[model samples]
Target: MPSHPSPPARSAVVVPYAPDAPPPQLAPLAGPDRPGGPAVPERWNAVDRSAHAPHLVAVPGADATEWIAAALVTARPGTSYLKIVDALGDVPAAVGAVLETARRRGLAQVKWEGWTTTAEEATALGFTPLRTPPGAEGPDSGYIRRLYGAEPAAPPYYAQTTHFTCGAVTALVARAHAGALPGEALDRDAELTLWRAATNFPACEPVGLGVAVHRAWPSAPVTVFLDTEDPVLLDHLPEAEQEWRAALQRLSRADAERSGTPVDPRRLSLPEIRAALDRGGHVLLLVSLATLQGFDVPHWILCHGTVPGAVVVDDPWAHAPAGDTWVDAHLLPVPDASLDAMSVLSPARFRGAVHIAPASTGP
Candidate 1:
């Protein structure tokens, strides 16, 4: 896949609040049209309209008085992830209300990018700082609070250096889990080398990525699953690009064979991926980021475990601030249904996956 252009950063719209007001009582705002509520800002409205399942939290004055703070939030469509997009007045109180609401709603995680609370305040409220990806600067970084008590051990996170290198990062994450590479070794030098070895440069194919992993650690077992029945990109690309893609696939297969890695013709299902994680294997999944971030691009994510109703993922893109904090993309919970939809690329309608295990595990 060609490198995707980075999306423009969304600036946080900060609404000024009254300097002095009585401490407020936090509650869920009934709807956008609740009577006697604080007026919703235009940015909040925009986010609400665009979000998957939007909700509002309000900090009303004590004794059923007046609205002191309000915020717009939504569950990331197809996932149990909740994001706090915009707020007005008493941000901390409003944030607390949102967190409570999310807990009640059974959301797995909560992320707030433009938080007004200090580190101490956020920690006191159960939020851990989120990390920003390397070489990317943003002000929207905030905290991530895991609602579920199940915290499975996960491989070290390696943020992609470029938009197109997520596949390589996914591979590195898998390698870290397999004990072939240390998580701290995923620096620029390592990333570039792995990118060159795994990617068909600009387009990282499943087979090619597996081949690179096998070559790097022959002891580790790698299984590459390609959706041969579905000619996803081939059906949509221009003739020249299609031919280029075909050549790349052919080369990737050849490399896999030469490197002694196993290439299987299979389309993985949700259960299979979950089972793989259960069996102590990490998965490098090719998914569409549009499902999560509203950007239509081929992306890669690492699956390490499964909760009761969601898959735990380590996304390579750190769109948050707080610079390498706890919730940047660590153990994110995506509902099974949403993961299924994201697994199949749009229009292209094909799925790709790579399962890797440590040397001791047999295929």
Candidate 2:
């Protein structure tokens, strides 16, 4: 993976809690600095009056472990809690507590560390140690690269194929927005293969989503128009595919001529895009990966005064609803569901293509 800047330091402290552990009867730490001033003694329980009372009741420092732990519990599982504490402080326990409270309150996906007394432990704690592939060590960083030839890129650790899946789709979507033509369909088959090979590796969902979005219009009824006035943005596109590049340039020139004006390479208005699609033209979603994180029709509604304009359907892809399902794309099938529902682009890697169907063509 590409090296990121050195992470901040972490404080040495352990918050006590177990996975599925019952909620602790919490007493608010006394703090005159708090919004309403320090908590009163009447609120303290018998445990609050003990030897740990003075320390527990004291106002937390900026690096307080309790504060750190509370924040982590809301995060996705497998997130680095040490990094949170390093940036904040010794509070894994406190974060776990907050997360536990949220879970009890009905948060289904509360984030917490998967701890185990035996390396083989699984069912009880809800964590199963993945077996090491031939010539590899533990679960965290092996398997994929060892079994397959793909290597992970910079921070967030995505493999080469994974990056290409997103990067290629992003470039294609940009071209389409600039008015590119329909070209050789993206390789969704290869993308799924790479994803399955890298199961348990982070950002797998983003990679898969990118491929699904890019390949959304294979022989589908969609037309893309591009602006010819602006220079092509194909410099960063993948080199393995030359046919795709030529098609984009053609579309851009055609779009520019049709509009009788220059297309803004930096931005495309929603009305203009929708009008083209309304007329049976296919729309290509061209947005950066950074902008894609947590993106949806709702976000576009806030920014563009329209639904995302593109609606991707869930096609063949892997999903593990139960622990019994093995991680393999071969077992998965293209879903008959809406693309948006199945191809969930994670906020972590926010960029890819989304095909807009015709006005008379969707739900």
Candidate 3:
């Protein structure tokens, strides 16, 4: 994470306004003020800024010479989640004001990302450091403050070993949630073994991940729903790469048939996916990151909770700005409509998912 100039003296107090209040238009801090900040991160220019615009707030100083801090109480775009994106101001006070507004808005949790401050600062503001994956080390970590009394049971997070290993990581998270794999083993040797089994090398297929889980724990039942009609790989690849993808696709299908894993003819509906989660099952969902980020690649995420009109996912990939990159993708709320649109592979039009649970609980 790059360093930035220390914010102006913490003399001003944070103040919050109604959601419908007009947002303050603060000038972008000059390079000197930002210091070592990146030139421009993706989140700085999100596709839908209005959706992520935070609740309007102003931090005023008693004297005219003191700088007035500008802040927004906003949620991540594309989901009903809350976070505080602060500017040159007092972080602690900003967090305090955000929590008050969150409580008033009936939000259960609040997150702070790329916190340049110390852990003591966060704790003082009632935020707890989030758990990071094993063997992972970086300054771009985040903290979560749960406003509700009891916290939901979220699946443990596992960072993918490679760019194409998201499917394997997603499967490992589901296994950990089901107690098939010990919690500690998720970040160590066991993770490598699972990745090897789940991956189809260059590309991980839905059937491959299901077969891998079944092989690791026979007692854990696995159900796969694949769009066999259009098993699309990267369409932009050259002829040679396309042929290689075709070979991997064929291999995946043959392996699924050999393992006797039942493959549904169509994609799983949002309602059916919700029901599976209600029954304590975790789903390894295939989606296009291009829909969320600009990356045009097939990505895998673990679906563990379903709210009214949204799905809570644990994405293995973190595409946030610097000092927040690769943080825990814990219980990210994605609208059901956006998820449905992202489920199908672009150009290829293929859809697939794998559901895993304890064998004792029938599907």
Highest-scoring model, lDDT: 1
List clash counts for every candidate, in order: 11, 28, 3
Q: What is the lDDT of residue 182 in candidate 2?
A: 36
Please list the C-alpha lDDT of all candidates, in the order they appear: 0.67, 0.26, 0.64
The sequence of per-residue lDDT tens digits that candidate 1 reaches over residues 279-299 is: 888889988877676777788
* Cα error, candidate 2, residue 205 (Å): 22
TM-score of 3: 0.74
Candidate 2's residue-wise lDDT over 288-351, tens digit each? 2121222232111001111222321111111122110111111111111222332222332232
Query: Which portions of model 3 show Cα errors greater than 4 Å?
Result: 1-57, 61-76, 85-93, 99-108, 114-128, 137-141, 146-151, 320-323, 326-328
Error of 1 at 95 (Å): 4.0
Worst 10 residues of 2 by lDDT: 79-88
Pairs of colliding residues, candidate 3? 54-73, 54-74, 55-73
Per-residue lDDT of model 3, residues 1-363, tens digit only: 222222223333344433344333333321335522442222343323443443444455565434345444555445545765443354555455556656565665677654354566666666677765555533356666765433357677777666777887888788888777778777646656776776655667787778887777777778889867544555767887778777776776777788877677787988888888878888889998765665667898999887766777888876544222334367677778888888888676778899885577954
Candidate achieving the largest TM-score: 1
TM-score of 2: 0.28
Q: How far off is residue 99 in model 3, in Å?
A: 4.4
Give stretches of model 2 more than 4 Å off.
1-162, 167-189, 192-219, 223-229, 234-248, 251-285, 289-354, 358-363
